[model samples]
Target: MIKVKGLTRAYGSFIAVDDISFECRPGTVTGFLGPNGAGKTTTMRVMVGLTPATHGDVTIGGLHYRDIPNPGRHVGVLLDASAQHAGRTGREVLEIGARTMGLPGVRVDEMLDLVSLDGREAKRRVRNYSLGMRQRLGIAHALLGDPSVLILDEPANGLDPAGIRWMRGLLKGYADQGGTVFLSSHLLHEVEQIADEMILIGNGRIVARGTRDELLRDATGGVFTTLVTALDNHQLAEALTERGLVVHQAGEGLRVTAEPVDVGRIAADKQIVLTDLRAGHEGGLEDLFLELTAETQRDVLPNDMSADEVRA
Candidate 1:
């Protein structure tokens, strides 16, 4: 397990990470999520000893990373995929890692196969490899030691859809076999699909952290948003509003703040013909994320700005 207690990192007057505490347990995939420059990378760097923490501590299995013997054999990390030696081939890179860990050379071949890098491709120089291929090679190197814990930052950044799916399966299987996986990403959908727990950060502090259902439950406060449409959407909207439920025009339907049954009962009492009604929690995570991090999000236009002003 990975434990971070009151972890903080500051550069002179600028604080990069601020008193954040969390845990990444074994046999689970924990996603660290945030917008760019939200201190996710700095926290990861402090956890692995690349940067000094101004306060608090981080430990893996009750020991600091620097204190662990041959830490790579116990904790696998791939913070930057492009940090590999450009002069070396992919195979050569893994070979060096395996040799440093005192593993047999065949272990490198196994990892290459595991990551779907064919023998021909493995012989290609790192400089010639595309970003996607570099990510694959980096993953191969991270898993080469078969460590119990893996820490990866934005592993899906350059991957195609199929490659992303493959990565999800691979990490899921690894956690299933009792490995701890701590992944970081700015993409909501990618983390939502695979993370067992999520930590959302903004402005150097944690805004929220929990399982998907738990976070959504807290955000909605037990009141679910329902989407409904009827033959007369205007009538349905008026009826819902009359019932003191918040209603908004949403894509040819009315988004109401009430249960489906409540909306249905109102529609029936109003003699309205309903066409569609369903719980609208599918986008709850995205909505909650945007709401919580609205101030930290980049390049957002002012709501009061006119279209002509924006064009100007």
Candidate 2:
């Protein structure tokens, strides 16, 4: 288990991470999510003892990282995939890492296979590798010590579709095997699919933390949305209102808050020439996250859309 209390980091007059607290249980994948400058990297660094905290404590199994006996043996961290020697092969990097931690070279080879980079490419210099391959090398190195807790920052940054799928399964498998996985990522869809719980931070402070459904419920305020495209938006809106459904006009259609099945049945009964009728699938995580973490202040994650575009 990992526990953080009053965790904070400051640089001069700027607060990067502020009094954030959360506990990650054993045997679960917990996603740490936030906008770009929400201090995720800083927090991770503090957790691993790479950076000292300003005014808080972070512990692994009731012991601080630095106080733990052989911290590397209990915590495997993959913070920067780019922090590798370009001249060394992927296999060589892990071998060195393992040796530094008093682990055998065979453990390095095992990690290479575990990350699916055991083939000929593992022997090639890291300088010749692509972004995705480099990420795999980093994972392999992190797994060298056989730690029970894995802390990764943006593990999916450079992965292709197949690699991403493989990584998802691997992380899930680790949790199933009673390992605790704490990872940070910008991919909301992937987190929704894989994370058992999440901690959301904004402007250097934790704004929300809970199961995916719990966050969704809080963000939506229990309002439901449905899309109804009919030949007659006017008639549809009127009928829905008459039936005590909160209805409004959208683009070229009507959006209703009535039960989806009931709305469909109503349309069918009126013979309303429906063009497109569907219910919203719990507003996308991307949308809810954007709304919860307003873009007015600090740096946000590099979304595909610009701030102005997101606002529009």
Best by lDDT: 1
- What lDDT, from 0 to 1, does candidate 1 have? 0.93
lDDT of 2 by residue, 169-241 (tens): 9899989999999999767778767899999888888878889867766766766678888888888887778
Candidate 1 local lDDT, residue 126 = 98
| Maximum-TM-score candidate | 1
lDDT on C-alpha atoms for all candidate structures? 0.93, 0.85
TM-score to true structure, per model? 0.84, 0.79
Clashing pairs in 2: 36-300, 36-301
Residue pairs clashing in model 1 are none
Regions of model 1 farther than 4 Å from truth: 225-279, 306-312
Q: Candidate 1 — worst ten consecutive residues by lDDT sum?
A: 215-224
lDDT of 1 by residue, 148-266 (tens): 99999999978999999999999999999999999999999899889999999998999999998788887778778899999999999999899899999999898999878999999
